[model samples]
Target chain A: MSEAGEFDFIAQHLAPLSQGYEGAFGLTDDAAILADVPGLVITTDTMIQGVHFRKLEPWDLVARKALRVNLSDLAAMGADPHAVLLSITWPQAVRPAQMQRFVDGLKTDLEAFGIPLIGGDTTRGGELLVVTVTALGQCEHPLLRSGGEAGQDLYVSGTIGDAVLGLEVDTLAGLTGVHKAIVEDRHLLPTPRLKLGRELCGLASAALDVSDGLVADAGHLARASGVKAGIELDSIPLSSAAETWVRIQRDPIATLVKLITSGDDYELLFSAGPEKREEILAAAKRAGTHIARIGSLIEGKGVEVRTTSGELVRIDQAGFTHF
Target chain B: MSEAGEFDFIAQHLAPLSQGYEGAFGLTDDAAILADVPGLVITTDTMIQGVHFRKLEPWDLVARKALRVNLSDLAAMGADPHAVLLSITWPQAVRPAQMQRFVDGLKTDLEAFGIPLIGGDTTRGGELLVVTVTALGQCEHPLLRSGGEAGQDLYVSGTIGDAVLGLEVDTLAGLTGVHKAIVEDRHLLPTPRLKLGRELCGLASAALDVSDGLVADAGHLARASGVKAGIELDSIPLSSAAETWVRIQRDPIATLVKLITSGDDYELLFSAGPEKREEILAAAKRAGTHIARIGSLIEGKGVEVRTTSGELVRIDQAGFTHF
Candidate 1:
């Protein structure tokens, strides 16, 4: 087929998928018009096939991950996702069936999340499949990382370190059966805590999604708010599977440090006053998500970690970074 | 350098560039918050290294092209450029100096267009460099391709075919000096008709940008409006350099057809009633851009083109398409 056939493919498979959104203009216009938006929250993320996920991974899960990561950004801001724009570059060897499954995955997520595919661009000629999603959401009271006050207590939702540990299990084959499957699922698909984020809107002082490790992301919150975050290492929440793996490790302290520093945990890490601790816990419980108080913001700079034995721990690497 | 060092690079280079936009939150928050926007115009475009441009093309022009293409979409919607979010995937071999030059180019265009860098993501992977820019604009009254009526006249701004001819010149190495430079520049940097598009908001009933050739894009406008667009081949404007090349060609008719069907003009194409011709001409004059009446919308399906001798012309290939 000629390159122009790409338009035909989009018209056939993708245009109908966007029919639910009137602003999409049947996916025929150069731009999409969004009207009656109360407040717009914008976030974008790019995922490369080999770098972000294994090449053998299912196309549907790949699509879901691409969309959900951006959705996670919205959830961090206490926003309700409304629309998404995707820019994808497919490798020349990609088959039509793979493309169909990918679109199907996007359609499922758009329906499930109550967000519509509004607009996007597709191009050919990349060594790897590259998917970039720009998600737009609405928030009445959008949370900012800079909103954390010095006296506010830091809280995190969901267990940490499962994703990285899942990566290790998948790569090294060190774990067996259910434990491996559980952690691998955590690595493949992250739950975006959307309900918990929305519930924290007026409750939490500041919030962000923990994609780049708890300690590293906390440093961002600290720098933005001009306050230091003092985290208790022992207080960090861990999944039962991760705890089992750590207990078996020779140096449990080292394993715990690695867990706190490993990235790709798409949970909400936020701050609120100590007075509102009960309210925050109630909100998390109502949203059916776990909440743990792991730290407090203090008058200073950067992030500090304190071990259970009253010793300060030094971290060699805080989180994942792209260079 | 460790992956955590990427944060240092972003802080040193990108964060300072985004300081002008208050909503960006110094690029520290998980998402950017856009408040008090009238109506949002969202458009995204992805450019692959080899497919879109030569691999060795200057980094600055590549950056400009990536940003301008999406800005052209906003112009087609008659929206004022507001902000941009970029998602870039660099090859593993890319040097920091190269990255810096690329960002400098983005900085130049962002300042020139008064559009701030709101937020984005950068990753390391892909054999070829890929850049995707999502431009967000604001428009109280936006133009739509579906707004055209059957009796409206079709008009196009600037000259067509220069960009494709420029590509031919670059690849074939047949042209040299000034002519080569002009066509190459046309391909490298598309002048988005922002002022003219804004001026045409209420004057033109329907509008689009001619990135996929004059005919194919006009077909898009036709399909969206449920009307037939009959274009006069002789009326299509050509740059002086393009005219010179055509005059020297063995088969000028074929050349004209190729020129009209060639994509990447990046000029505004719109439809308006014949009664508003004077107003359209005046708007173009005020914007200091040339406007020409190419044809009219008729009662039918698809697009039709007539030669200067009043003979119907058949197009073999309508425009450039990505497979």
Candidate 2:
């Protein structure tokens, strides 16, 4: 028969998925009503096709990335995600199968994180597929980037630069086998350290998700706190595959610089007092996530990187810029 | 000499506007935090260039419409807007000046509505400019479309069909002066009847904002409440301009049918019990908005319309569909 109508499409594929969420009103009402909570943390992120991801990327991964990026923001704030509102602007070329796969991926991640897709809006746009997810989280005292003090130790959860390397591996022809697979997975899916983030609520003085380069994000934290950040080059964490690739490459320093400057890591970059180091480590151990002491907040302003030998490094470009 | 960077852009233009809102954290943190309210209402709406509005439209009106539509949803639920999260996917062609104008327009509405722009995402997309606004509102007891009963009186606030006619005026040639301006204003900028909506919370048994055609939206209310709505075609409220146009037109019945089928009214369509009619009228009077008793909900399914002479009318197209 004729193609399914808009209401029919939503009722068949989307409505059933939202049944358990009492506030969603079965997606029948104009807006969803949420009960009172202690505090609500809200973050929104928009991802565009071709600009944010390759057109050849699977729908599942695309959907997961869109949701995960917002979750990463919530994690940065040390909040537990409660629900999500998704807005999708589908490209004219998108088919029903593609839409189904995208929703399936979203549902998969929502279930994994225990966050319900409460409500959203779907519309038709131009050639690009634009997805925006507004994640609502709860935290009594949400972490702020401005909370860092001058003497705080800057730390990051999980290894960085794998996503950048993954992008390179996908674009380049030389990489192959397990190395490529690992980095590609990192690029396709980012693990938002929600548990560790919630655990770090009272521990981390300042926090943020690393979407831009490490130094750039550190600069943000430093500027917000009116302090300077000093990052030691040798202390920067790297994956085994990335280290192996760095060892094989001719210019190791340039590779390291690229790793530090490339964005899209999605790791929690935070700062805590030096006295809390043991507690931080204990929390990380409990969460089963690695923690790295990469830098320190100083008395001045901006971000400074120190070399392995003790020389201060001057960087030209710090991170990715959309405009 | 070089254009301001993304962070600089946000700091200079966006940060200052968000200073008054304590939860916004001056737009510096990863997410915005909101304190507890009695009840929370969330709504999201997406508008795309060309499809939703002409590219040539002024940035001020475009931004206003984008925000107002989401506010309309909150109003439909009898919620008072508290905060908004905006996600905009800007096209590459957008310049710094254009961006400033868009933000200025958004700021105007935020100030006017007394709602803060708490958080959002800005990214580059393809040719289309896609804007999504997620409004967070508060209400002790929100209105629902499913609350209407069989004997309830169906009433509509303000006027209908002006927006649709406005769209026609923009695309077609003929209309000029006040008529053109009135319809165009209705189409371009919608005033979210927030006061009236909040006032109707205890009075209106069922309520919704008319984004799609009246008959179709009435059908939605009908299906949600498991009752049939009977609308008197003659009772459909029309602006004086629209009424004048109807009187002058050769085929008035077709014009009226088209008006009823056209969408984007943004007026509140509600149902109330006959006993609460006086209270509803008083509420409308207090809110300073016109209310029209168009029909009643019957013990059946779907929506039916009767002509001035008592002849029943059938509509082929109920409402606008995206798919």
Candidate 3:
């Protein structure tokens, strides 16, 4: 079977990326199927030209980012992604060769993540390109934000402030070239903590991916669990570049606060009981990722930042959102 | 769990449409879980403003059409749709109330189809409103276009040409108001012949929805099946309004050809053995829809149309695509 008109180009380009998944049906059928029954986790994310990315960004990277964000959501739910359904609203201005580059990039990551493209739609419309990816996964112990209670230790996988800090090129202008590239790379290609999320399945009490700022997502976790998350400002994890950028700031604590509030961090923010600390560290080690206990969930509401000595750090809060 | 920022509006408005699906989890979790996957069939479609619809189209209808198109794909595969994951990139120009109407429209169909909203993502960007829907379904035996054999009888469920004809207001200007309204309604809201598709699961040798016009889609089915489809021009079913319009046309056959060449008919076109004719009619009766034996597959290639007397009718075949 072959894809019909308007959609033929997609199947011609992407059928190879289906990776022989029996359900993909060579992208010939209008729909794909998953034959077996298991716990299914589904998440979707959309990236549009000019909004989620600059027009000059490499098509491959844009495709990868579009995919990883959804995979990150699956990871946050402690699910291992198996397949994806993509919907691309292509603009007339985008050359077919550019779309081929986009598909090439998608193919690269689809193979890397071992998640095949099972189904999708390709259409011509809009002046701005829009890509929407829905990731499908299966997990035995799915994580949730409402699973935590008071007295749970809040933890984050990998470095927190880097991705957000990576966006502040002006603040990092004085830094070394290598340091600048490190932070910028973090912003461009975020490695989803899939293995770590799977490891935390039965361990973490609550979990979610921090696409919104750490503080904001922490507030979400707290609100969902009906508790307050108290984070020690000094304890937030940072990459070496972030550390260097913060050291030059007149008020280092204020800079750190700003880092935590400016989102685009695809890291996982989660909570677990104190009893699971050793196991979590072990899980992180096995996953080859770092985990830090940045804060603790307490009886209250919303998120609060405090110094190591318990001195409260009141954030300006204004312009904290991306809008 | 509760939804976080950037997606709060989607959850708050459409969460009610989740319809108590366990996987929806109140649209709170980062991803939704479908605990039991019974042969999961998935399909996705996207509609962008100024492309799929005009700026004046009602948001509610736009939302329904978006969902229905994906559902129609599932129907083409002889699957029972169970859930959908929506990704809407809301434009800044679209007011909150307008978005509310979109959700309301989505809610109406979600309930009508009994397909719950399991998961989705909402972000603001672009000057065009983009709505992408990924539908999930279950089917024990999915019908496929490759299933047809040379001798199979080609059948189509329900009328075909009304949708395309509905797009031409100037062509129908001389028609009565009631006749004009009928075709226009068919254009605005297409009924995905889901029940008919489900019934065709075992009976159909090949199947697909007619979104690409009857003749074009027949070409697709024939090419996929490695055979030829010979359609009887007079056998193509039509609504009363279409019949009346064709009667007044200076060239009725030419008008018919034009109608079949233009797309957007969400009807099921399939192939089955003559042995299943009685059974298929019974099935269509049970589905409460009309069925017509329009064509037959032969040991050849591509599609051909003929009159009742077997006279060849050549279609211009240009501008047949919506693009």
In terms of DockQ, the best-performing candidate is 1
lDDT of 1 by residue, B45-92 (tens): 888788777888888889999999999999999999988988888888
RMSD of each: 2.0, 1.9, 2.5
- Which sections of candidate 1 miss by over 4 Å? A1-8, A172-174, B1-5, B171-176
Tens-digit lDDT string for candidate 3 (B35-101): 5857788988888888888777899999999989888899999999989988887776668688879
Q: Tell me the tens digit of each residue's lDDT in model 2 across A1-323.
A: 11126677667767766747898987779998875778888999878788788877888899999999999999998899988888887877778788889989987888788887788877765666778888999998888999999988999988888999998785534555788899989999999988889989999999998988797889889989999999998899898888887777788877787888888999989999999999999999988899999989999998889888988876777765555
Best candidate according to TM-score: 2
Query: Could you give the interface RMSD of candidate 3 in angstroms?
Result: 4.2
| Model 2 ranges off by over 4 Å | A1-4, B1-4, B171-174
Report the number of backbone clashes for model 2.
Answer: 0
Give the per-residue lDDT digits (tens) of candidate 1, residues A221-306.
88888899999998999988888888888898888888888888999999999999899989999999999999899999988999
Ranking under lDDT, best-scoring first?
1, 2, 3
- What's the lDDT for residue A258 in model 3? 82
Give every collision pair in model 2. Answer: none
DockQ of each: 0.71, 0.64, 0.57
lDDT of 2: 0.86
lDDT per model vs. reference: 0.87, 0.86, 0.85
What's each prediction's clash count? 0, 0, 0
TM-score of chain B of each: 0.96, 0.96, 0.95
RMSD in Å for model 3: 2.5
